[model samples]
Target: MSTPGQPKDPAAYAGPLSGRRAQAARNDHAILSAARTVFLQNPHAPVAAVATAAGVGISALYRRYPGKEQLLQKLCADGLRTFIAVAERHSDAQPDPFTALKEFVRGIVDADVHALTVKLAGTFTPTPELGELSARAGTLAQEIFNRAFEAGALRADADANDIPMVFEQLTAIRLRDEARTAALRHRYLDVLMDGLRSSQGAEALSAPPPSSQELGERWIAPDAIMD
Candidate 1:
């Protein structure tokens, strides 16, 4: 069965696999799922922690991912895919702009996208593939925000560039129980959503909306990104 951090298509990996390779695929799934948990809890964690968490030998973990940087890249690439999928799904299918935006926000939160951001940002220099996917995700997110803004749903003061920072703000609600942590994120997200809606008497933002370049600068050109 599919689990968090596992590739979406389990059966069709790198063409058909021999029995031994099939076992390796299964081990890969376990390794990714465990790594997600271990690293999210602690980004600076040693590689052995992932091996122990995955219930695999250290050698097996290394064989699958040459190093922690590779592992971080894979995890983030998976998260960006999820983020893009949710944005794409809601970008056109929903008729109500605000509702669509809310659902998209909820989907990403459910996917634990913010947790990945809170835990893993800057942990590795992203490969070119990851960088491309990140840019795609950002474009989709902006499209979603623009739709809401054009429809007079989202506040005029906030723009798509604010989305990442907004999600990062919500990532502060960590708790011992992951479920509770998720619940709290949604709870605050709902509050933030209310503030984001266009409404009378909502003061003009004291500061100018952040430029895309400002946010883009955070992810070094030498690398890749979030939200």
Candidate 2:
């Protein structure tokens, strides 16, 4: 027997409680968007400032992002998601494994030139979270290279270990002051891919002759003169 003044059963409110949780998620996403804008404007912005920008209370900001590092991690993860989606789409388009790999490299280069990764890096130091994100990206990249090598798109004897090094160098060229040489970089990307292609009766192809190292040696001149 319920007293006249008694409240209804709390169990009757489960559906509304679930809806509130979903609404909280949406609000958190909005806060993240605001934080992202704030970070882009000032990578070192204080949490209070970001909360102000997001139009949320400081307590709410803390609820969603406990610290600067967590915010940075979320930003890096968001950027990686964009890149991974692009790579996966490109990978799906190629009919052959070798072509797919080449296209994948091209997509990465394109991303380097046009994606927000460089901009994000310019705004803030890469945190450990960013390093983890890069490691995950490396897994996809390695798979692409392996598929290319297995399909005879790369040199028959290309060292698997060296492939990652080459990729890091190539993709990183976009940050070079000399990346103004887009034509040159494209040429280099192609030349690097050619060297990786298997030479089993594959006629030796000539690429634009390699040039001197640039950007203080982070960018290697493509080896365009291999047989």
TM-score of each: 0.85, 0.47
**Residue pairs with clashing backbones, model 2:** 153-197, 154-196, 154-197, 154-198, 155-196, 155-197
- Minimum summed lDDT over a 10-residue window in model 1 is located at 218-227
Query: How well is each residue in 93-118 modelled by candidate 1, as lDDT tens digits?
Result: 78998888877887777677667754
Give a tens-digit lDDT track for model 2, residues 1-227.
Answer: 21111122334334555676765655566566666556655666787887787677888778877887677667666767555665667655877877887777666665442233433443334566656766666567667667777776677556445544444566545434644645566778788877667766765435432232221132112342235
Best by lDDT: 1
lDDT of each: 0.79, 0.58
Candidate 1 deviation (Cα RMSD): 4.1
How much is the lDDT of residue 193 in candidate 2? 76
State, as a TM-score between 0 and 1, how close model 1 is to the true structure: 0.85
